[model samples]
Target: MKAWRLGWARGVVELRQSFSNGGDLVSHFLWPVLMLVALFFLRDREFAGTGILLGTLALPSILGMNAAMGMVSMSQQLTADREDGTLLRAKATPYGVQAYLVGKVVSVAGGLIADLVILFVPAMFLVDGLVFTPLSLLSLLGVLLLGLVATLPIGAILGSAFPSARAQGLVQLPVLAMIAISGIFYPLTALPGWVQVVAQFSPIYWLGLGTRSALLPDATVVVEAGESWRSVETVLVLGAWAVVGLLIAPVLLRRMARRESGSSVAVRREKALQRVG
Candidate 1:
């Protein structure tokens, strides 16, 4: 109990540090803005904004960036700590490992939630000249929450998969690939058949589908929506993803810890020391 509370405290500290570092906020808003701007110019032509498609497309991009940041940042940062012996020292104690992991989730996920809200404001404003019902607002919130729940566990698992931060870049390739696979920029209709098949296995597509349903009009065409824009299946899939992610993360993390090495710790420590010196 005390350990969990302490973890929350540590998580809060990380959240603050994440916010203080402006990189996330910029990336979160910038890419989406560029996409929106490009769409704006395209809207002047007959090819874009013909219907609800834009909202559906944009929702996924926001959720994807949020999910990406949480997973990649948390994984790399905590793994860095692990390779540096921070988590190893905790592991020597009874509940230290649990505390650290809890704290990490709290910190990373909390920042992600804030970033989602920040994106929400622009989503409303950016999708202007369109009708937004009360139902739309509720759906948007639902999608955001569902996406958060679903994406965090993926982050935790990835973070714990590698032995150190040096391997983080490699471990994170899947996440980067997810952006392209999930059809954030182009429609999934345009992707090759195999790529689309691979996307179904990634959480990114589910998030994009969910968010698009929440924000886009009922009549808009979605790549995944064979019949309807707001398929109950999207919510179900996202919920399933979230549950599985949460369940699997702890086990994978434990496995990563078991694989930690002494030399790895020493090398990481030396790196941190070099940075400080």
Candidate 2:
């Protein structure tokens, strides 16, 4: 209980810093602006006989994609902390590792919510056909929560696996590929059957599908496979990933924590300085 309280406070502090820090502030706004630009271009485009504007379909999916990206941010933050010895310092304190993990999750989730609002509020005016009821709000909230649970653990695992920020760059390609095929900016129905099947396995797809289910009208189901939202599959697949990741992350995090030391941080800093030089 004490650790959780401390972690929550730490997270709040970091979240505040992200909003105030110049570089972080730019990052917080830049991507959302880019996405809004994309939304603007797509706002009027027809979805090829679907009687739906592509923007209407894409807006919610983009929200979902943004939510799932908490994973990437989590991975990157963890890697940065490890390199900078934040994780090591936390390890020195009682229940500090636990606090650190909780702090990261809170900070990442908070940032995601901010990014969503930055995009969603402006997007509400830019897109149409969205349903906004109390039920839909609750549904969107549920998907966001479940999506975080499913993805954050995987992020922790990835963070633990990589030794440095440069190595962490390797994760970006696959994530970008996943976003492309997972139908963030496009409809999955346009893709081949095999591609659709493959996309279903990803949490990104489920996040998008879930968000669309909440925000889109019933008629939009035509664009989805089986002409349905597959709510059960969304919960099950995301839950499965959550379960597996929960099982594996602690062990890996603990192992990684064990391996960190003053020497390792110095070595990484030295190499980083050499590269800069």
Give candidate 1 misplaced runs (Cα > 4 Å). 21-56, 92-94, 129-131, 222-224, 258-264, 270-277
Measured by TM-score, the strongest candidate is 2
Q: How accurate is candidate 2 locally (lDDT)?
A: 0.92
Candidate 1 — which pairs collide?
Answer: 75-159
Per-model C-alpha RMSD: 3.6, 0.9
For candidate 1, the clash count comes to: 1
Cα lDDT of model 2 by residue, 99-218, tens digit: 998889899999999999999999999998999999999999999899999999999999888888988779888888899999888889898889888898899999999999999999
- Encode model 1's per-residue lDDT on 153-262: one tens digit a residue: 77777777766566887866767788767767666666788888898677677767666666555555544536455457777877888889888988888887776667
Alpha-carbon TM-score of each model against the true structure: 0.80, 0.98
Model 2: residues >4 Å from true position, as ranges?
A: none
